[model samples]
Target: MDLEVRHLRVVCAIADAGSITKAAAGLGLSQPSLTAQLRRIERYLGGPLFVRSRQGASPTALGEFVLAKARTVLPSIDAIQVESALRAGAAPDRRPLRYVATPGPLMVGLLEELRELFPGASPALRTETHVPTAVDLIASGQQDLAAVVEYLRPVPVPPPPDVVARTVATEPAFVLLPAGHPFATRPAVGLAEFADAEWVLPPNQACGLFEAFTAACVDAGFTATIRHEAESSAARELVARGTAVGLGQATFRSTPGIVPLPLAGCPLLIRQVLLWHRDGPLAAHAREITEGAERAYAAAVRRSPHYLAWLAERPPPGAEQGWAGAGDAPP
Candidate 1:
């Protein structure tokens, strides 16, 4: 049978993952099916591609050669698909851009920019609590693009195949406290300082923020005492009323009864990425969206007095300087 780009991708996945089971999971295929396909591929090439052992599969000499070729060919195919999608997006019959994102300050700005970019096309904007869900939608052609925020941990999860992601912004997270809270007057507060403070965190499934917050607290030698399940609006209100404290984006606006303060070491950072399928029509607009989000985040920082003060504070060495000035705002 003639080989295709998809076949090459499968081979590369197996090689990179170093196991059929892992490769199958990454490729969204069943292990038995992937194993069968590998056998057929081996037969078509007149040789075995992998050396199977108790640990995992390793590439044979011939497998290494084929895998190298696949690596080279797959990227070229991806480039071709991206270019084609760009052309398709600009075509006269192009559909209106459909985009989804987790609701936040960055998305608020991104949607506005998209509207301005495609005035003729009424782009669809959707809110998804989970970034992975947005990524899946874009990959499945259900959406044109997605704005996702990933909390960097010890091990970061990779995006799905055929989906391209661009880092739009990377900024430190902040602590939102009541205006009258003692910590509100501090230049910066550490997660450990709030160990005994009640936290108003969103549900674990709402976004990566909850997980990141808890993880940071753990690293600081404390467990966050979650008193209320809240997000964006509710979290704001809770912090404002002094009922609980919560985490906020660096670009978070200062409310009447709340203050946003940066963390002492800036251990928690959120990386905002714009994602789209390489073969989808919206691939061409990814850059436009990314640039727009950056601008919007900067604007938000400028409007947020508390964020400005947090920026003025002495950040720890090697801290993210990307969000220092209004030009480098992050959400």
Candidate 2:
């Protein structure tokens, strides 16, 4: 019995979480079901793939060897799917580009840009946040593309082993305050000055951004008081009403009643990146959509005096190399 892609995926998830139960939950499968899948794979390989202990499950030496091979073949499955879809006459516009994003000012122009560039294309967009779910959705083929803004220090995420990442932009952190707040008059402020101030942040997957925000405050010798946890727009509302001060990216759109102050000496700026499956060749429409996103990103940056500085030549940090056929313009 040859081990299949499903089996390898189950095994890889187990290795990643180091617990079969957690892995099952992460992959949205029952523990028994996942266990059964693993058992069959081990039987086919004629060896134990994971070593179970009080500490949890760790891939055995044999398991690691098998996984290395599985990794190589897993991507081919996605390629096969793409080819099948293409042969069936899946045009780019009609073909869904499964996209997952967190609603923020950065993404405001993304969809419009896609519409402008690929007029006939209709993207299937879903909203998700938190790094883990976003990564899993892409890996599981639930999403074809994703937009992400992560903390300055790297979070524990699997390397883009089966996916491709493109860094579109980086936004310096800003302290958003009520329009008339005392600090609003200051040209810039440091995180330490707001150590005791109440803060509002994004919820859902955007929750992970707080981790980096907190870490930066830790470095600054103070703890942030979280007043609310919701979407970026909600946070903006909170700051506008003087409920709390909050962090924001340069890509954010300003609400009339709030002002943004530069967070001096804070290295916790948001790094935005786009992700897609490496195994699948992008459809012409999807390619056009991404190019449109690039243009949108470029225009949005140009419209903002602060972000315009990033528009210069050198690549923004964490910006992955562009896709082979997906360039600055549509093919």
Candidate 3:
């Protein structure tokens, strides 16, 4: 049989499932049927794909080579299919309120508030934390709006030429610690205190956040020792289990056995920015949308005592913190 997308899928399924029996079950095929198909594919490809063992199946050198190509081709195909379906069904008179965002639980309530503003236009959010990906999507006209964060302290994260952004709010970053950690009870921690501590940095790279964090640590007189990189849940687990400490958003949720603390001097501050292509569809509404996002951010800030306390000490960015002032004026 000639190799095809289906053949590539079968190879990927087998590699992902790690065994023929499991792959067969996952693909809804009998073990013998899947094995015969796999044998044919191996013959077509000129080598054995997976080596069978008592533990499980593992890809051989040629299998790894084929798997790499399959993984790349699959997502591109999925994207094309999704785009085609959307275009095929899209209405002529109505437009959806499309926006991109990063991974943040705080965005749940914010999204709800935003939906009310653009009535009849169902906005589908695409979550993207990688700086280039968000910028590229906006620049290419794939998405015109995004609610993104930029590290504004120690080093300011500059937006690319393709996009323009206005600061919605500047929120202080917090540190996540195990409940039993020595510094958990401390009202605040000095950046230098974590100098020798193993850290779990944010998974995002090339976004300037990682660079800004490392820069802050260096300014505090030592380089941070980053032992792991992961998403929020894994970072929490690592912190809770006393494996590695990590940074948290100011509006970070109250997780049991975890303490989120402010860093003294407020070395790390994240500016919640509303981004759009400078000349794209959202350009006209950029200020208004940014203001609306700020209102949601204001309500979100109320959930965190740290944000409230921080506001009390310093002036809120972009005119005001509440809907009355910040939301009323365009920055």
Candidate 4:
């Protein structure tokens, strides 16, 4: 079989995730399919590229060499595509603006801003449950812009060369518990306070949030007993009905029977990012979209009474500054 950029990406994903199961999730592929593909690639190369163990898979010598070359080649290829698109004036004025995002209240606010920014230009919207998939869509020119959530630890995965990403906001995660649950009325609760509580967390493949949530639970000296798996609306519904507790953004709207509390010590954080093809039709509006996202987040913060109270107790420096200036382009 011939090697391709997509195949190279598969290899990199496996190396980075350290396991086929996790890598498949990141790639939006099934584990079994990815495993079979790996076997074929290995056969084509005449040797195994990974050493699998109970913990995960590690690259073999040949795998390391190939991966190293892939890292260099893929980015260059991406750059060429971007440059070509730019020179070709890829932005088509007739096409409706395409926007994709991970599900959340933040997206609602962003869409509102978009409407105000481009009057009469209704953008096409898609909700991707996985951040990497949303990013890949933008990188592949399948979407014009994407709003994704990422964790700040272990370093965020870099955007593909064809894409440019900027951080619109960084906010601490809040705990959502049953309104009558103990510590629900507290101003702020530490992770340890919920060590024994049942968690309704999104699957790890949803984004880095899952991993961060698990790590925080471990740091608090207990493994979280995740009883349900859902993301966005479903997760919120479970928390609201008092079926299980979950984590949410600071701007989480409190529904009846649901209490959102700031995590004391702020051990977990979620970064909201906007990504778009660097040379695509939407590139010209990148700054505007980024600014809109920040404004939307700031508005959400102001709307959340619980978040407001937490900010009042220990205000972050420049808390009052509008979020427009808070954005920074990710490397």
Candidate 5:
């Protein structure tokens, strides 16, 4: 059956808002008009499409079925409109690639590389001090991509099925401490040595890396006492002052007054990953930015081969060593 764009817009809006009043508001339609349109559509399909209750409304089984079809058709419709505009020579330039990343020295380098690659394109980047917020941003399609820390030991997270994640780099995490701290002179020190030390860590919502930090300490046979919880950069800053100690990959930039020592004899910790939404394909400009990031990463890895040495360490129980590296830290 032939359907107009308005019908699909109303249906999608209702599914997204879960209330006719809210959906009507979103579509700038009066409640009565929305109700009439929905009824007409249902009549044409010969069935009810929604189940309304006190909680609100939900798509019925048939509505869910229709939504699946709508998703496929709507994109095609959008594509047609875009192509039509292009043919009329009135189409706007493609939008910039939007991505979220945890800020660090390596990240700065990567962005520089991406800028060089896409000299004409404007890319927007947001600094997320926390992983969960970054992940949520990308999952919602608000950000085109995100960089999150993964652990050597796998940890579970709630994400939509279409979110694609991969390990871009695995590096060993160092224990950053005050310059004069006892462990600063050591070539490497294991978690057991710092069992009683205070640590500043990433917020727990950035689950995997946070778990890795505490679990590494636990594996060494003690509970880590969190004195301050923070993002990677702040945690390192705290460590440098000798107020706390933390897990950091070699990718960490040296902050003033902080001495980074190896987390020696511990199972090598590796940063977990890279992620993007599979539902939205990267445009040519975005892909070029991605490639620039890859090139910069490779250059950094070449300069610091310690990650390679750390990758050689045996995997801890329940850990996969597929992506190897020196320190477990953020990319």
Candidate 6:
């Protein structure tokens, strides 16, 4: 008999379950039947796959090699099966678009664009401040696409094995100050300028980028006197009341009492990425959403003179090479 994906699953199941009896129970087969099947599978591969004893099953060197290949292959097969079923039953007017993101102006723009692109299709939207939650939703096929940002802290978020992150845009973190603050009048201010002032720092993220913010302040000359932690609306209120300043994204708005100023050297940065499950149904439209995200970000730059001027003076490295993108703050 020809070896197949099902045969590989049997090898993997025993390794995961750690015993033939447990694997058989999970596979809905008798212990002897599973043993017999495993024998054929091992024979086909020309080796003993797992060493068995009272301690349960463990993969041999050959079993380890085969199991590694199976782990990668299984996810792809499952993704393809899911994509096929959705496309088989989906009607143009009935197919739904699933979108989830951390937060940003790009989400609003992308929603409008997707509506126009697929007029009759339904839309589902979700927000997750925790980046991992959004990543898991997409990887599991529950979400079609995600607008996620990776904070440029020392800790890096490596791309998931089955999910692809396409760089949509890169954006620099900006300083939010009261409208009358003396530093707001300057083209851009350094971290040292706010050394003595009280601050309303952005909420602690799962990514720990707030640490990067603190480190930058340390390099500049002083430690931040953090008075509170808040989201954009709350941060704006605090900054407006002149109680504390905060960090914000390029797209974060300037209210009558609060203003966003570019940092002197653009020290803190984030890259915004569009994520999708490999071979999933919505993978084909990744390019379309990326363009929509760019359009949304461009409109933001037009609105912020400080951000636009800084970019004109020195464009983000990612833009010239391939992309430019975001901070985790509400924008």
Best by TM-score: 6
Ten-residue segment with the worst summed lDDT in candidate 1?
Answer: 321-330
Q: How close is candidate 2 to the true structure, as a TM-score?
A: 0.63
Q: Which pairs clash inside model 2?
A: 129-205, 130-205, 167-319, 167-320, 203-230
Q: Which ten residues in a row have the lowest lDDT in candidate 2?
A: 320-329
| Candidate 5 residue runs with Cα over 4 Å from true position | 1-94, 154-159, 232-234, 266-268, 283-291, 299-331
Q: Tens digit of lDDT per residue, candidate 4, span 1-331? A: 7977778878888997999999999888999999999998888888999999999999999999888787656544554554344445453233455689886655778888876766545566888878778877776565677887765553345677667777676777888888878788788888997877898877775467666777777888998898998866788888878789998877788687789888878878777778777666556666777778878988888889988888787754221121113233433
Relative to the true structure, candidate 3 reaches a TM of 0.66
**Candidate 3: lDDT of 248?**
79
Better of 1 and 5 by TM-score: 1
Query: Residue 17 deviation, candidate 1, in Å?
Result: 33
lDDT of 1 by residue, 255-321 (tens): 7898888888887887777777766655556656677877877787788776677667654233232
Q: In order, what lDDT does every prediction score? A: 0.73, 0.66, 0.71, 0.74, 0.63, 0.73
Going through the candidates in order, what is the number of backbone clashes in each?
Answer: 0, 5, 0, 0, 12, 5
**CA lDDT, candidate 2, residue 62:** 96
Q: lDDT by residue for model 6 over 1-331, one digit each (tens)?
A: 8999789878888987899999999889999999999999989999999999999999999999998888667656655554454445443332366788887766666777766655544556778787788887776555777887655665555556677777766788888889888887888888888888898976765644676777778889888899898876788899998888888777776588887888877777766777877656566656665777777678876887766767898866453221222222112
Clashing residue pairs for model 3:
none
Write down the lDDT that model 6 would get. Answer: 0.73
Candidate 2, 33-81: lDDT as tens digits: 9888889888898899999888989999999997777666654565565
Candidate 5 per-residue C-alpha lDDT over 12-120 given as tens digits, one digit per residue, 9 for 90 to 100: 7788789898988977889899999999998887788899887777999989887777765654454344334433444325345455787543355666764565444
In model 4, pairs of residues that clash are: none
Runs of candidate 2 exceeding 4 Å displacement: 1-95, 105-108, 112-121, 154-160, 204-208, 283-291, 303-331
What CA RMSD would you report for each candidate? 8.9, 7.3, 9.7, 8.8, 7.1, 8.6
**lDDT score at residue 275, model 1, on the 0-100 scale:** 75
Task: Name every residue pair that clashes in candidate 1.
Answer: none
* Best by the lDDT measure: 4
Taking the tens digit of each residue's C-alpha lDDT, what string does model 3 give over 1-331? 7898778888988887899999999889999999999999999999999999987889999999998887656544533443343445442142355678875532555567556655444657778868667766665445657766666544344556656666666667888999999998888899999989999977874555787688789899998889999877788899999998998777787788888888998787676666666555556555556667767877777877766776787775441221223222245
